[model samples]
Target: MADSEQREGMHYLESLPRRWVTLYIPLLLFLFFLLFPFYWMGLTAFKPNAELLSTEDNPFWVVAPTLEHFKKLFIDTSYPSWMWNTIIISVVSTFLSLAASVFAAYAIERLRFKGSHQIGLAIFLAYLVPPSILFIPLATMIFHLGIFDTRWALILTYPTFLIPFCTWLLMGYFRSIPFELEECALIDGATRWQILTRIVLPLAVPGLISAGIFAFTLSWNEFIYALTFVSASENKTVPVGVITELVEGDVYHWGSLMAGALVGSLPVAIMYSFFVEYYVAGMTGAVKE
Candidate 1:
């Protein structure tokens, strides 16, 4: 009776069919749900318009794929410009936010000053303040500063949200590092800047990578600020340009739109592919460990 009772809850699936039913089936379903959109987008981007508009063909697979949509996207539109703007904005804002975050997080975590914990909490609270609440005021500020229609507006405004998030994330990472190392450096006549530069930074690479990825992703996808601050089509980022420019009144350019989305998403995907190791480490709380 004891043996049977223990086996009831603890026994693992012993048969191949049982494991397949319990594990592989669920995983396949989850993957289909997650990846179906990308697959559809790619299919639409390559499908000829006649085939796309036709109802008789199997929508699941493209009967014939062509590069016409891509050709139109690059040759007939300002996709290249939007791509450049997004890349510039995402990269510049990410670096700016990461730099400020590293300093702020180090000060908050290691400087050991009064109300440091309170300050950290305040930063987290600030991040919780949604962009919807902030955009109107930020619009006024951007207009007043005469940067409302330029890439600089996005580059500058993005840091407002990015800093708090990166700072909060890095604060936890910095706290995870040993304080004894800092103390030893101090005793050895190392200045605060030297310790931060030489000791802390090396250990914090994974955290920094994680923060950079977050900042970059947010800046790339931020729509409210981009739509509000930048009105010029030429200066628009991919998110705004793709949605706004591709739609004309009731007519939507589905093929071109899908192409833009597929192209626009490639940079972020590439970035993740390159830094996935550090990002996974950071999320798993394993930096410098």
Candidate 2:
């Protein structure tokens, strides 16, 4: 009986390696799949045009490393203007969305106004509505407003989607906070506005930060609206500008395109890396409620 028990234990121990292999093999493969494109882009960014156009089987390694592509992008192209336009639009839209969402969230979460819950649900549902459905009407509105073919068109359009979802996310987060803290502040003769600004907002800092980061990244990486609304070359955002204008016909400027893409992605990557923990905590807190 003891020998049988020992054999069973040994079998369980031996199965551990198999279980690990089963779990990790798929994960490793998925990681490789996701990473290979970015790796290839990075490699191609460093390669010269000669290497890029070479009909070589393994174009993964740079034959001659050079900053020439980056130089050309900055010096020869209107990339700087496009980048500046993207920055302004993204920053402005993100800030507006964050401000609007926070206040709306606070009101919905804390105030016992009539139909607040229904309103929250309705707003969230509205956000979930497909952009394709609204783009035509939105474009018509933009034309009537006389902001067509301008970056302001994108700035105005973006907040319509961003504000609602961000408000809902933050409403959930804010509801998770204990009412006892607010009650204590009330006892100390604090007004609702004061309490929100001084007490509640500080405690919900992680959630606010997470919402801000989401808004910023979304606005920054937006391509569809930028493409549809703005037609002027100088007013194009990075994503649309690079892909559309850079490569003409079959003459793909692979190295410069890769370099531009890499540079454009850096800000978003850094923002995510820096605020990742806060973002996770915010989402977790929202879920727990």
Candidate 3:
């Protein structure tokens, strides 16, 4: 009975008020910190130019909302094309990266090849190398390949960063699965390919979704390579297109820019909302020896 009372006290942090102070308040603050930027973007997206520029009005609240900015974004610019390019590149590159990462992760984690530890570490280190430095060489390759200024340039280049990180992440998740499953399949005369597709892939859905979400988010927001490689306005992805094309020399379209940014971010937000549970599980899961 003493132990039970202690456990109950611990479970609720000794009282409701203390629990709310420690847990609920911190969580609310974290949510505000994380979500406030998006909220501000939405507010700015809807506020008219007059209200936005006015010094007298409450800056935090939008007194009036207009869709003119969104209308201008879609009708007056190449934003639709940019949106399409972003979607295509993000999806194609995400799938390509996920596929390559899966195979690489399986090989590194399951194959137990010589120097596998070092190779795995090397792959992760490659992910840590800044894109700012790599884009110079990558730009040269894109030019030499004659794919510069095309959507293919970004689709191809994104995997350079995406694959390594996804591979490292998936390697950990794959390690969480039992070797006995694969061993049992092997004993039943299953080929390596069969074991991978039939046994491993099915169980690794959460990890795969997590990796795909990561790859997609990175590809969607990638700016450096996109800017360096694509010169044409129509070929530019949302991140580059929204920022570069919306501004005239010495002039910025604040309203349209905010609208574009808000719209551009919705897809990623929706993707996360859909797979958040799986992504959390995938990140937290680990193997126990």
Candidate 3: residue 7 lDDT (0-100): 69
Candidate 3 residue pairs in backbone clash: none
lDDT of 1 by residue, 1-289 (tens): 9988887874474788987898899999999999999999999999999989989988888878889989988988888999999999989999999999999999999996899889988988887899999999999999999998999999999999999888888998898899999999999999999999999999988788888887788898899999999988899999999999988899888999999999999988898889887667654542232
Model 1 ranges off by over 4 Å: 1-13, 281-289
Taking the tens digit of each residue's C-alpha lDDT, what string does model 2 give over 1-289?
Answer: 9988976675555576786688678889999999998898888889987777789646768767999989988988889998899889988998888888888888878985888889888877877787777888888888899999998899998998789867877887788789999999999999999999998889888778887787788888887788888888998999998999889899888889999999888888898899998666655644554
Worst 10 residues of 2 by lDDT: 280-289
Q: Candidate 3 has what TM-score?
A: 0.89
TM-score for all models, in order of appearance: 0.91, 0.90, 0.89
TM-score, cand. 1: 0.91
Instruction: Tell me, by TM-score, which candidate is best.
Output: 1
Q: On TM-score, who's better, 1 or 3?
A: 1
Across 1-289, the per-residue lDDT of candidate 3 in tens digits comes to: 9988976675843688987998899999999999998889999999999998899999999987999999999999999999999999999999999999999999999998999889998997887788999899988998999998998998998998999878988898789899999999999999999999999999988788878887788888899998899988899899999989999998888889999999999998898889888656545542211
- Candidates in order have lDDT scores of 0.89, 0.84, 0.88
Measured with C-alpha atoms, the lDDT of residue 137 in candidate 1 is 96
